[model samples]
Target: MSKSQVEVNRFKVKAQLMQLESDPIAVEEPLQISLVQNNKSEIFSLTMRTPGHDKELVYGLLFSEGIIENSDDVERLESQLHEGERQINQQEVILAEDISIEWSRFGRSYASYSGCGLCGKTSLQALELKQSRALKPIKSKIDNGLIRRLKALLAEQPLFSQTGGVHAAGLVYEKQGELILSKTPFFEDVGRHNALDKLIGHELLANDLNQAGLLLLSGRIGFELVQKAIMAGYSTIVALGAPSNLAIQAANQFNVALIGFAKDQSFNLYTADKNKVVCREPLD
Candidate 1:
């Protein structure tokens, strides 16, 4: 399980009154992901994340960034602790013999913060071509009512409920324009991309990315999130927050259905070919 929150003492102040309380702050830590191939291993990325589901995070990240196509591309994943630390703070991914990787393209020598996704890219052209998978035809449609219900389901995340500082991503399926939550587990991280990566990793490990026709994000939809969704083959992405202009452009180019501001039983479709989303009864 991911360590979602940590207890800290704080002083709460009200007009002329102060109370000491133990607050549950969201946990954030540095996670070093390393890639291992041909008996040689190198640090891949350093990210800030909540401790848990680390292996899934690594697998999802590698797959999303075009490092490996599928679960079969990597033989196994391992973790290494810092000096005497008991917890596995560093992770290593070993590629299968049949797989070939160009580690130079990964920019493994650089470290990026959780807030930015393109920090390591050498050029804008490289970022544009990051996703190796060609866009697949989007055939899935989601009803407004089902999307609202799915959003409500996503709100049940225990980590965010306790800390209110984490982001979440869920894999959802569309059935007859209705929503179906895949068995793939949900992921919560301090970083939005990390959460998405964890969710992607879960689906990859389960070998059911196709079943996840829709993606629900707890935060705003941005270029990075859009790219990850496209890489993972999601036809639709619903976000609780607004969508960035670049995200809209990417979705339009890829023919993905992008919905934003999904709240109060209504959502704004940023880009959906043929206006596929069908609204439902007004929220009571």
Candidate 2:
């Protein structure tokens, strides 16, 4: 089984009381992604991520960076763990023979950290990714009752329940005009972006990116998350935390409906037209 948390002993001190207890900690590890095409290979990115869904992570990374458009663009994906190691440290992604990579455009030293997504880029412009086509508009609405249930869903997270030190992301879809998130890929990572990427990658691998759904984030909505959602063709983003100014701007530009600080049926709509979000009752 893939372990998301590790058990460790820690000393807690408070009010002249000290206690030694066993605690679970979220696991963090390095993941190196390499791209191979036409018998040539190059290191694409090195990121700090929780050890799971490695193949999905690679798919999300490649899709977000505009390296691969459709799932067919990838010829093969291989992952290997170092000898005597329990976690996978490296992954290789081979592109289809007909696809050509823009080496010069992606040529930059990048060290992706677990805390933020736009790390290692020299300029602000580098953060903006150009897409070959605009994201198709999403035409769906989730009720307030369904939104409130997200808290319960998050509460059931085994990793977060044990460690309380990870971000989570999930995908929700509509059925018969009602939102239903059944067996959605729930990902948890020390980094919020990585969690979202894992979910995106999982969907990409299934070739189900065109499904009408909302990307629910356990934390704040940021520019990177918005960009990744856009790249992954997600039309709506809902979060349990606040949205950054840049994230709102990006969502508005890309026509993504962004919601933040969602709790108990109350949420702040940061982007998209007012009519785009239909609540059963007045929401704050």
Candidate 3:
């Protein structure tokens, strides 16, 4: 729908009879990201992701990796089109003059795949070395009924509905005493982390991360996803898939509520403060 889906011809076999049909597939392409400072540029990361929202991907990845503190650290984003083509496969992020970078933290020795978020880290110790702010306690209660609706909302994502091959990340917030899913802030990508990065990037650029909200993931919850959510200061996360053991531990460590296996009728809350998440009956 957004240049992220490409139609492909495939064979459909039905009881020994084969027929050719065309279907949409999520586009996967390499993005070479570089960081620029003081007129010098250096390659930051190479990741396979969907082609659209490249700028947001860069912003989100940098923010997640602790390369940049806030949107102010980014001066501007520049895209490099493939020679004579309109497709953007590379991005250059110009950083403020005063910003400092620690190259050792990246440890990227290989191209990162769309399904893997912890590709380059040498070990768990490396991740722990990066300082994350202490997550503040959630002051308001979250309704379980609202959490159950997250998956339904994500089901409406155009990219996933078209290809069924991409993961989605969305932000839900309270407004006018009612919970509302953000319409413009949702993102979809072949990689779950990239989708979340895009959402975080947009919020970072808009300086709206302080708003208390719940992060929704269309797939399984992993350690990196929890790490990213914590880095972004989100106190609650709901996913349609199961969570990894590390994710559960991290959520407990940070005092963040990690909800997984979210369905239309039921969901699992892995970790949360007592009296924080309330169970409510479905409305008729």
TM-score of 1: 0.56
Q: Estimate each model's TM-score.
A: 0.56, 0.57, 0.57
Give Cα-based local distance difference scores for all models: 0.68, 0.71, 0.71
RMSD of 2: 16.1
Off by over 4 Å in 2: 1-108, 111-114, 117-120, 132-137, 281-284
Which whole-number lDDT from 0 to 100 does residue 51 have in model 3? 77
Ranking by lDDT: 2, 3, 1
Candidate 1 clashing pairs, residues 3+ apart or interchain? none
Model 3 lDDT per residue over 1-284, tens place: 56776654433322223345654545555677778999998877767576787878888888888888889999999888755445787788999999998776655533464668446532213445232555544455555456555666888899999999999998876555555665536899998989999998988898887766778899987667888999888888878886655567677887788766666655655676535555555453
What is the alpha-carbon RMSD of candidate 3 to the true structure?
15.9
Q: At residue 56, what lDDT does model 2 achieve?
A: 82
lDDT of 2: 0.71
